[model samples]
Target: MSRQLAVMMVLLAASGLAQAVTKCQNGSETLYTSASCPAGYRNVTGSMRSHVMTVPGVAKNQEADRAMSALRMQAAAQNQADEEMDLRAQNAFWNQCLVIDYRVRATERAMQTTEYWSYADRYREHADALRALQYGMGCLG
Candidate 1:
């Protein structure tokens, strides 16, 4: 049993010495034999290339990613500005309509028995004016 174990260990050492370990610089994937390594990859050991050699197609993908990120940020900023403008316009219109409604109601009360039809017409005209303002501001569009 001792002689057989010694023979097995020797065979293992011999086989290990016969193979060359190669590691790709691109992704650090190791290979048992140098011949099994892919064509575009170089060995980590002493070779004719620089250590910081970038893998093919990596730079182009990075550039595209950067451009896409910039475009997304620009689009988000534009959307936020548009939303703020709409909110400001809505608040202004609401305040104006409230004031107009209060004034018209007070006028109706003051002329309770006189010029009722004219007061109603005045309220309709104020409402039409508000609609026109909304349309011009692109709120209705």
Candidate 2:
């Protein structure tokens, strides 16, 4: 068992030093494909360019910017709702209610960061972050 453990440790160390995204296609030097890592580990999409969304049929330079703007709008509106709650507590001088609301919002926000957004029309991560941030802002209120 000791010998096996030593061998496994050696293999694990070797694997840790090598992490390469595979090529998107053979002979395609400019493009690289995303590779799956070990189980229970997720690749941060920001580190890899594989997930960039592009609309092939749309031939406009501002399309991407416009789409992003729309997402921002949605995120802002969604987050703003939570702020109103904070304002209410502040106006009423309800410290207990404010603290309780913030605690609940904080927990929800933490969970939202990793939650799967199925119906969001924009960047799901951005949407989640917005929701979380709004709740966080409420907590601080």
Candidate 3:
């Protein structure tokens, strides 16, 4: 996992004033966090740094899980319909590096049932799942 993601796991465990002091400064991404948990404030150290992706945000605690699951399910369905129609993924594009249709000549060595998707598909799917999880946890209604 990326250092940012790992730090997120730790930050998530912390809350209230404690979390407030645990800032992940990117010198770019602007985000605010709520001070509600009881862990108390303290500066976290040894967070990983990167040259490209600057992540910034705070994770909030939600009391309900079932409600979130319902909302996420509904959202996923809608998103899937939109995605299928668009034939697209967000983290990366659906590259046409190879022809999606047609097969080799009759003398071809062999053939597969369906063309393999670009490797980025897995990453995009993971991102979508994570998004659903975070959205579910952060929502109230």
Candidate 4:
């Protein structure tokens, strides 16, 4: 029984030694052997152990990055839409100003050509009111 136990112990130690490996790197090339690395090769066994370690938060961080990117894109699109609406409103306002200016000029011409005093006074009042509106809107500039 002692002889058998001794044999088993020797076999286990030999197996453990056989399982030990040395990892070596030369530039981009890598080698794994049960012996020591050759000259000109760097031992990378410690680095190999570090590479197997699990780093926490890597997946969660990637998900958060994607969420932030999506939010930024949504904000940019909304801003563009708001700008387009503002531009359309400005165009409509300018069109209204142009029509009002034309009416004011026509009223002044009528006041100059009319012979009836009351008609001329009415035209004058209408023109003044249109000019006041234009000034209030900053359209006169």
The candidate that achieves the highest lDDT relative to the unseen native structure: 4
Scored against the true structure, residue 54 in model 4 reaches a CA lDDT of 23
lDDT against the true structure, per candidate, is: 0.58, 0.50, 0.41, 0.77
Ranking the candidates on TM-score from highest down gives 4, 1, 2, 3
Q: Best-fitting candidate, measured by TM-score?
A: 4
lDDT of 1 by residue, 17-135 (tens): 32233444556543323344677666664552332122224346568989999999999999999999999988998777666556655655555655567876776676567666655
Candidate 3, pairs of clashing residues: 16-36, 16-37, 17-41, 18-40, 18-41
TM-score of 1: 0.41
Tens-place lDDT digits, model 4, residues 1-141: 635643643464454423345678999887765568999999897876432222233456668889999999999999999999999999999998999999999999999999999999999999999999999988987
Candidate 2 local lDDT, 7-85, one digit each (tens):
6434643554323443232232233233544443544434434333212222243577798899999999978977987
Cα shift from native, residue 101, model 2 (Å): 22
lDDT of 3 by residue, 75-126 (tens): 9999989988676543223232111111112112122222445544554455
Order by lDDT, highest first? 4, 1, 2, 3
Q: Give candidate 3 misplaced runs (Cα > 4 Å).
A: 1-63, 88-141
Candidate 2 lDDT for residue 46: 48
TM-score of each: 0.41, 0.23, 0.18, 0.57
User: Candidate 3 overall Cα lDDT vs. reference?
Assistant: 0.41
